[model samples]
Target chain A: MIMKNDIILAGVGGQGILSIAAIIGTAAVSRGLYVKQSEVHGMSQRGGDVQSHLRLSSRPIASDLIPTGAADMIISVEPLEALRYLPWLKKEGWIITNTKPFVNIPNYPPLEEVLATIASKPHHVMIDADEIATEIGSARSANMVILGASTICLDLPFEELEQAIRSVFGKKGEEIVHTNLSALRAGRDFALQHKNQA
Target chain B: MQKMILLGDEAIAQGAIDAGLSGIYAYPGTPSTEITEYIIASKEAKNNGIVANWTANEKTAVETALGMSYAGKRAMACMKHVGLNVAADPFINSAVTGINGGLIVVSADDPSMHSSQNEQDSRFYGKFALLPILEPSNQQEAYDMVHYGFDLSEKYQIPVLFRITTRLAHSRSGIERKAKRAQNEMTLPGDLKQFVLLPAIARRRYKGLLGLQPQLENESENSGWNQYTDGPDKSLGIIAAGLAYNYLLENFPEGNIPYPVLKIGQYPLPRLWVEKIANECETLLVLEEGMPVIEEMLKGYLGNCLNIKGRLDGTLPRDGELNPNLVAVALGGKMIRGEEVPSLVVPRPPSLCAGCPHTDSYLALNEAMKVYGKGRVFSDIGCYTLAALPPLEAINSCVDMGASITMAKGAADAGLVPAVAVIGDSTFTHSGITGLLDAVISKSPITILILDNSTTGMTGGQPSAATGRIAEICKGIGVEEEHIRILKPLRKNHDENVKIIAEELAYPGVSVVIPTRECVQTLNRRMREKFKNKKTE
Candidate 1:
């Protein structure tokens, strides 16, 4: 059977979710899969909530936007943003999200309450992506960490994703690429460890 | 054919390039800016000697493109839906003047007001101007339609309106490129007086335009972009227009929508297909991305005719962009209800970036205007418009692009002392300059605060026409050189900036205060580029 994955990547503006989408989209295209991505741009980029609907399919994709409650995965760079897109997630959708709260508003919900809301999801993996990236010597690679956690749900070959990170960040230099790869591995390891424990 | 992934805007730009376009003119606006940007970025377009440049506003852009068309070269003008209002005069008149070279005016509509002030549909403009419109359903169609639009425009001797909504404008899909044609040589219209719109000539030209309606409609009927696909069920007929077709097709991934579908991309209504579907199906569902133009047309003025169900009949929403989920429900599919977002997730509205020059400028303006009080300051559109929000509710009015200076002048004329106008540098050039000229001529007691950030900060920092020429333009507009004060908008210079603003506010004549600073975003981008270059060195 041909593989099809409808993913919603969510985050605040400047959270580097577009980079994540680009990396995954490049990977999907390289594997000869049909890819369509719809992104939020313009005024919303000023720290507002943003989400990109990315669809990868072996069959031809009709729409750039994924249908609500049909998305296979919700990968978010921020905890609150992950919950914002619950309406678009399928019943069996996996929520791979970073544990950080990008507190820009005055009345942000308590962190524990936000975590509890995400925890309510049937399949979810929460990780301190920023901490993991920092530990891996690249604090800015938190987006890659979140992407790494999503690999558990994504059906694409892991090696393709690793290669995507290299190509997408190749312009940044060899050091940054190495650091981001390590961050991705750390996030994957954490998810695997938690899943094994459960 | 080489296929490349492109946004709908980029696809249109690429299509125009391949269609032998000689020039593209535009003013940067969301969802539409990328069209011209793509043309400017293309090495092929550059080598082809295409004239792609930002105009003062949509009006100048359209007029310039019209001039290029008069020279017998394919040209395009693009802007947001609201920008159409600014270019409406030239656009409407172009239909009457007709064309020598092919002309396509692209109006990227924002149905949900994504980054726009209003969700006005541009299809109405096309109909109002009595011009054929091409509304593509997908990125590939967006590409292919540009070539068709230019051909239709040339064949009919009328400018064609190409309309797209925000969803299609921003979405990305793989598009197969066509063989590129060479650019047209400079060739003038056969009649020297063709563009001259004297009353008698205009009447004749208007008649000529009115006479072309049949041909335009005939073209739309045979346009291939418009299709009538038969289905098994006759219970419901779907009239899907533009990007709404994608949403409709998305509901039935198997490509087996039971209802007969008439997918419309070209305008003149395609009456033949419409009549066919109306005769075939019992009930009609009109799915359009923008306002219910087609739905209302199908329903007619009376309450009667076919059982038409759409935005007006409440089958779908009256406003906002349509998505697949909404279409699914309309198609009688089960509503896929997912978990509701927690109320704890507060709204995170867009704000000025940290270290934005507008923040410091607003702070200083607020302090300076504290004595005279709030509500006296009028602001224009840009990132600076965000100052109307909390922490710095410095500006009172944000009516339009250049309303700040004019509104402030009117307020001052009505005896409001120290009436201030806060406008960005790019906006100042866009339309604010004319208002300033009005203020200067009347000697209106207004402190026009032109925030010279050296870029159009709101729409992704496109190079502004007023970069180094603001002070010169002010002086040329007859503002006193002594009263034109420029200050650095920064935390450290806050006190000095406030003092300068206060001095301008106290001036009884037209005084200009310019808080000069580079936009933080642009500054960071420059620094990053510089750092990259240094590393390479």
Candidate 2:
């Protein structure tokens, strides 16, 4: 079985991009599948645009980097961050992005236009993951929510992801794990509901 | 075999741990920092009494690791590519001294300047020292090669340079474990003066080292790490060294490249295989990262030049890094590119944190510099270098670690009076103090601003070597005690800080102004950790 998924996880630095990768990467590794995750650390973690290339496959993976125009999907926690990695996406690749705008830069373009551009993609899911997370009582779980929304596009089972959440966040205490799980399920539900919508 | 999903740095650390490393020493640096960090945090290492230390600087780290190796215990020293420059003296000298215990110097290079000032490959440093170089193509190799490298080092009684780039350093993949080896028992060298570099013995040792080159190349050929696989398409021969090998394979997803390929994981060029492929194929494609060391070496006499294609010939861009697409394009294929990034997406450059002390310090410095005009502040490496870009635009130069002080002194000598030098606390100890002494002895009219953030914030808040000692260090360096002023870098103290800065700038002699504050990120992290413990209660 030749199973493979190349994902580009994008967001503003410190938005927990690595945490999301930890969850998915752990899930894939637990299944005894091949996993390669490349991270951006050091200077860029100080509130700059950052991205991680996460590859999962049944067979041994060759490259740590996802080749240009070969990513299976782009899962972004911020709207503008979503469009930053368009070059890495496949022709029919899915783009799952949060609707929130991280306006750190002075000249961040209009949010509506960014959202509309994401909307123009053939396969896209626009989500208010921050709002969904906040409504569920944990604003910090927005990244988990975004990760949850991308699960539909990912080939892994939901139970595998839920187990991954438990293992990755196990040391942080049960409350955080619960809140993040709720955020994840809420995000997954939103994607399930709005996946086919115009 | 046990499996662990590990970053390449972590894999190397684990590899070293399993290979019976008695100690590891390093100064924190991107890509390479995690290697020492992993060992420091390992429970097994603690149980086994393995020593892991964060040294004052790369030079000190290498010397300390060499001391450990001197005791007949396996030791490792790690740092980024440029850090090797700081440790070059000991590193090169160690080659002449030989070793009783295995010594591996791991240099994590940044090929694309991802988190570095420049991209300098460490393999050349290895070759220059006449030592075998191991360049792992992936995480598993990164792990296995540690054992192989240690064996090679002990076998030859010489040091091995293990080079890795930012991608391999930062990327994570599966790594399989080998059986654990016991640490070497303390045993002195058979000769008492083995380490002493007296000219009489040095010539003999140097000759011995020179004699080891062919044997080293033979080891490279026989080592399983270097492989030469034949392909049906002999028209274009490919030499993919280190991580470039992975990219070549990535371009061929089916694992079938239509060319004769030489995979170079261990270097000294793996001469026999190189000559074999060179003789068998028509044209050669050198797909190595960083500079074209292989390509340059291949272009030896122009007599046997077989149309070598790489960075030198512009087949691939001379600068930056090599990805699968770049390799694909070099192989006469079109690179895959999708829609261009929309104009709406502005560049979000990395900046200081919202409550960063560097922000307030740079702000106050900008106000003081208004009187002296601009372009006199020479900033050194650290988070404050981010001030080079932004609303502050406070600094004019950031050349390297601890360059700010010397550069400022040079400018002052050249009649740029009131020249300002901005350096971080950690960097000051790293390389700044001697420059400070130089300024004091010469009595240069330079105002030095040391941004004391109490921690090395750039590389994830490693413990600083200069914590709480900047003032005393300055006073000890012979700067006038009265001129060495410490100010709190905060918004409420902005005007006062600016006043102090201006007054120091007007001083005729050397003056050190320290803006002391805890890094906002470290502070936040501490508070979060404290809160988490409370929650755990």
Candidate 3:
């Protein structure tokens, strides 16, 4: 049996990708799994690309960074981010990502072409998480939606994940707490319902 | 139990509040700025009677906190490790004078040189002062230790030093906070002679400190913070300190590393703990962060009996932070490969934020000083200190807070033509005033340029104490009214600022030039708040 699970999250700036990764990392820890989370928030505030490494294990974790192609799962909040981190995903590992494009510089692959290429792979699931986030409330919470949708495949306790979401936003205020929790559940429901269709 | 999320620095501030701190004096520096800021922003602190304010610099902060302790009220002083270097005089002397009420001096250190000038460990300061030092592993212990620290201080009647590095100071952790304790009532010293630090009394106090050495050693020996645990193998032992202990415990394979572990927290190197570990094991690995202080202390105590290994022999890094993998590798465990970070170009050094007011001040200073000659600009630490960096290498010297005025005075007294001291308003008040007084009384012919960007900019824009008083202070300090000039610092008004600076530099008498500008970061933040408020309305 595998002793640990490694997940990679990548995105462009101004997306709520960090929040999504934090929630997953927190949820893993709450479920009694040893978790190590690290991020290069960097000059991301300056509109740079952002990536977070989240590793969960039954045993103790050491480093914050993960080794190449060691990720059991790669979840990208942005389309190009998914492609950018493609090499880090383990052979035959699952890639779950939003189809939204966030191009900082000019001339990247067209959104459809990028998605088509990723879908041609044996292990990929694409969703318009931004639309899902907007329907729920704010498009910023799309990252939370991505985490919520990816939960089914995460093989962790849903109740504990809910607890983690509540824990992070619970102190902010009631409205924010409810909206994020709703976003999380919506993402989860969407992923679970579409697993067979995909 | 009330569960709350707190920043590590905020937890320390809350810890001080919970521990019944009557007063806290601090000079703002990154990683340690929040401790003073949280206290100032707290309604509870104001209502429950805690006096929290930014002193001019670390020296004044230390001196003021010591004065509060003299009145027999619980007090805490806070500063970054470099600030400790500035406050070292009072700090070393405080150990000799001892304390009346409980006292805890917090030195928030920045390891890896994050937002700091140097990574000098505060544990060395603790050892130098021969005072008890406490290093908390995480935020929870940071809070608990603050409370425990005061009690320990009062029990020992010696001020305790609480050291937290950048990682522990910035990391978020859940802390279960308790109700605030009642404040200690003001009490006069029973023996007034003890409070008076005249030479005779100081000598007596120095003797008292010396006599208390054995008791301090005993306290370290029996501290609840230190513990020992048996491991799978008696052949090897682990000596982990502070956060290193947490990392060691986390990486212990099978919850059983082939070593007995001695977790040391209380300092002066618990001889008992070291002896027990050394006697029992053939090989011992020392685990600690930031410095080799503990390993050095152990070498003297444990000798070469145990094959002691740590930062000294590259068992671990002497600088930067420790993670579980480093501890794991030190314990002869399997090497855990980490993600290779994409190689990027060398990072650009931090410069002044775009449109910062200090930019205009530097522009003016750079232009004004060129006529006199190169290397005439004397500056001090503040946001204005960034003027020393590239593109605007305008400042000649920046020793510490208030050193600009004094240093300029020294140069002028030595007959250096057209010397000028450039300092921020917050820095002027912090250590600049006394130096100004020195110039005024001595009639030193130095053109003191008080850069009034009405906030402490470098440490994230805390309120500059001389908001509306810089001009008044210059007047009150006996600066000739004719020489006290205020010019708006703006690129549009750049000509006027430079003209004023030039006029003052040529003046034979002592002069004060006030270049006034609001901190751009503060203005931007306020404008956003105003927009948000208007939308709400």
In candidate 1, stretches whose alpha carbon ends up further than 4 angstroms from where it belongs are: A195-198
Give the alpha-carbon lDDT of every model.
0.91, 0.92, 0.78
> Each predicted model: what fraction of the native A–B Cα contacts (within 8 Å) does it retain?
0.78, 0.81, 0.03
Report the poorest 10 consecutive residues by lDDT, candidate 2 chain B.
Answer: B299-308
Indicate the docking level reached by candidate 3. Answer: incorrect
> What DockQ does every candidate get?
0.81, 0.87, 0.14
Q: Output DockQ, candidate 1.
A: 0.81
The lowest-lDDT stretch of 10 consecutive residues in candidate 3 chain B is B338-347
Score residue A9 of candidate 1 by CA lDDT: 95
Candidate 2 is graded, for docking, as high
In terms of lDDT, the poorest run of 10 residues in model 2 chain A is A189-198
Taking the tens digit of each residue's C-alpha lDDT, what string does model 2 give over B339-363?
A: 7798888899998999999999999
What pairs collide in candidate 3? A66-B339, B56-B430
Deviation from native of the Cα of residue B450 in model 2, angstroms: 0.8
* Residue B164 lDDT (model 1): 92
TM, every model: 0.98, 0.99, 0.79
Give the Å shift of residue B337 in candidate 2: 1.6
